[model samples]
Target: MAPMGIRLSPLGLAVFCLLGLGVLYHLYSGFLAGRLALFVLGDQAERAGPGGPDAAPGSLPEGTVDLRELLAVSVLAAVKGGEEVKRVRESNALNEKAKGKTREGAEEKMTSGDVLSNRKMFYLLKDAFPSVQINTEEHIDAPDKEAISWDRSIPEDIKKIIQPKKVPAESVTVWIDPLDATQEYTEDLRQYVTTMVCVAVNGEPVIGVIHKPFSAYTVWAMVNGGSNVKARSSYNEKTPRIIVSRSHAGKVEQVARQTFGNKTVIIPAGGAGYKVLALLEVSDKKQEKADVYIHVTYIKKWDICAGNAVLKALGGHMTTLTGEEISYTGSDGNDGGLLASINVNHKALVDKLPDLEKASHK
Candidate 1:
């Protein structure tokens, strides 16, 4: 009974297109820069820093990894992340129902829809995707970060390293383990938070979806550009044309304005997927630079998923700060900074970009 694919109205389609190719997926699934997909799965990827599966192959003393083991670890990570957010969501709901609009808490609060969406998220991840599976251990001590799930799309070698529990994914191949920043979500913020999974066999994704267990809506897509299960988002559109971080607003806002002009509009703060999607929104205007996603910081796999799929489907591209092609099943982006270039040429950006380390850090 949940919607089965990505659906968009003419207006929604235009909004999605402006968001990013990832936001418009169904054409193809990819990871996003911030995802421009809707929300970032890497709600707290920055906290995880760069280790575990994210480690460069050669950087490891072994210079190799077992896929199964990697999957297990990632699954563990995803589960912890999920649980933490769940707790936050429920607590926020209870607190809000008591306060009833006279609340002063700045945390974005959940709506009735978020509660229902949690059920749907477990359904798709557990039942829909054919190539992915989820295993939850109640007593499992989640890491400091939280939200954990296993991924098997990686090659056998990586699987061998992780020693993951091999199981059949649902009809959809992608497994999105979304953890929208609970802090932001509970604050009743306009931007959504989520992580997504997109399965591309021979370079085509038949599956795409986003799960927002903390908001009134859970937006996702499947097959082709059908906006199934649309999540509630910013309709008020004070339209300042600015981008703020759900978790790190002050820092990201400072740097974002440095790149985008001071006059840029500010979208309500949300997760990376939301940010990526927000970046896409700017493209609707005439500034070609809106398409360009500049990474002065780091990123991760959970951060990219559905966003990546949406953009690639629409002929857009995401790269590293170095302008290297980003790999989803290959590496976690936080290790290498990310850069998204819309219709514009990013090679020029890479060529001209000053070292943030030298300039910003200075």
Candidate 2:
């Protein structure tokens, strides 16, 4: 023997080592399989109802994602996208990064985060509803012609929500704003940043979702369908609370003074969607919610579509100060200065501010 300690031959040692490695590999594989099983089984509720193996008879259609599923997907995409943007902003090199511009001449303020998030949502939606037309704020592409992937884990219950009749892609459209308050986002006003998505069929909004990334709250609805999330707001205050733009406070106070009088409390906020949410948000034990959201300057359609949908679902109203319904799908800019309120005082408030449309021209 070479030595007393080296009793076993090299072949024996090699065999022992191989056996140990095999055992380790087997344990690792088992762990991975267990994890995969957990992930697949965790969302049981999502897979329940008419789509599961025990699905209700005749509950499904040819193929589609319903309005409720669309709203849920929108919130999911927005929150995930907002998280990416937040991470990018947290980096020390945010301002040093270059920004892209849209066709409208406004700084696009797109980061890798935005592109990635937009693509992620697009793919997710496209996979769920292969024949639907979808559009986004970052890029102007012919949505009807875009390609889609077959990979998706969407539940059958979601697909059954689509109408039994197939709608052509050209007739339906979905608008997405991966990050709504790009300016406020760059300025570190995290609360103002939101991810928005709207679905319009034949130039009308059927569903909308607005998600506040930093706050992690989502407001979404189908047109005139009761809001899935209820927000308790006490509208008992003597003086009305008004929400105005933080970036452009031009003539807002003057308008408020003329419209609601000197007693009204004005709250400055960024992002049109957030301003609308402020109307429903109650602070502390008391209620300090806004009674109205008034903006005289022109705003993009993506900024208010989700807000309008949610407000409408709550029996609230958002219309031009001149009291006209704002149409979606055909245009990007909304020239009609908006007046939104959750209370029944919409007509009363509109009557109070009769000159807003004329004032906007000035």
* Top-lDDT structure, candidate number: 2
- Residue-level lDDT tens digits of model 2 in 315-354: 7788887888888767787887888888657788788777
Expressed as tens digits, the lDDT of each residue in 1-362 for candidate 1 is 97799767999988767778655574455544446534543644443334344543322222233223333333333343444455655565424332122122344444332333343344434432323433221112224222323343444433432222222223213334445443455564523555344443323433333444334333333333333222222322111344444333444455546655576444445565655554443322211223344444554454565555545544455666566665544333345555654455557656655453233232
Q: Residue 360 lDDT in model 1? A: 21
Which runs in model 2 stand beyond 4 Å of their true positions?
1-65, 92-108, 140-171, 236-238, 281-288
Pairs that collide in candidate 2 are: none
Ten contiguous residues minimizing lDDT sum, candidate 2: 158-167
Residue 110 shift from truth in candidate 1, angstroms = 14
The 10 consecutive residues of candidate 1 with the worst lDDT sum are: 230-239
Tell me each candidate's TM-score: 0.44, 0.70
Q: After superposition, how far is residue 284 of candidate 2 from its true place, in Å?
A: 11
